[model samples]
Target: MYKRALPPAHYSLKIQSFSLLSKSNVDKYDSGVFEVGGYKWSLSLYPNGDKDNNGSGFVSFYLSIEETDKLPHGWEVDVNYKLFVYDKIRDVYLTIQDADGAVRSFHDLKTQWGFVDA
Candidate 1:
């Protein structure tokens, strides 16, 4: 984990009136398509935590590849990614990444990667 003044370079998801999600019983919410590294992607947010994945009391966030059907067979993407949460009061971001700083491989078999408790 790290703290910095800059926001995530690849993408960011900001939810206004976030409290309404829990009030409305939205278990999961997916953001619209966004492009990165020539591939389409989206953010999956579990505002009230994903109970199925063992995220009962914490927020679960994930990055999902989109439009994978368009990619070639056996396609894969190597990504060194980081997730961030902005602290409005502090004016900084709390960033989280793999401890080993490894490049994660995304392929047909696995299209999502993220923190179960974010």
Candidate 2:
């Protein structure tokens, strides 16, 4: 992980009243659609962690391709992505990505990539 002043180049999601999500029993939240690299995408956030994925006590984040059914059959996309959390005190973003910066392949079977414990 690393810190940087610049925000994510592709897209960003800001939650103003984040604490209320847990109280309201919101297990997961998906951001509105955004386009990147000629494809639509969105951010999926598990505010209280995704228990099913063993992400308890830690935030789980993922980038999901939107409207995958619209794409051609057997379609695939390779992406190198980073997940960021804004550090209010530091005024920088804590960025996390694959340790080796691997290019993850998103296909019909796998439509998202992210950290289980972000």
> Candidate 2 clash total?
0
Q: Best by lDDT, which number?
A: 2
How many angstroms is residue 54 displaced in model 2 relative to the true structure, after the best TM-score fit? 0.4
Give candidates' CA RMSD values in order.
5.0, 5.0
- Over 6-35, each residue of candidate 2 has an lDDT whose tens digit, in order, gives 444578788877667766788999998999
User: Which has the greatest TM-score?
Assistant: 2
- Write down the lDDT of every candidate, Cα atoms only: 0.83, 0.84
In lDDT terms, how accurate is model 2? 0.84
Cα distance off (Å), candidate 2, residue 51:
0.6
* Stretches of model 1 off by over 4 angstroms after superposition: 1-9
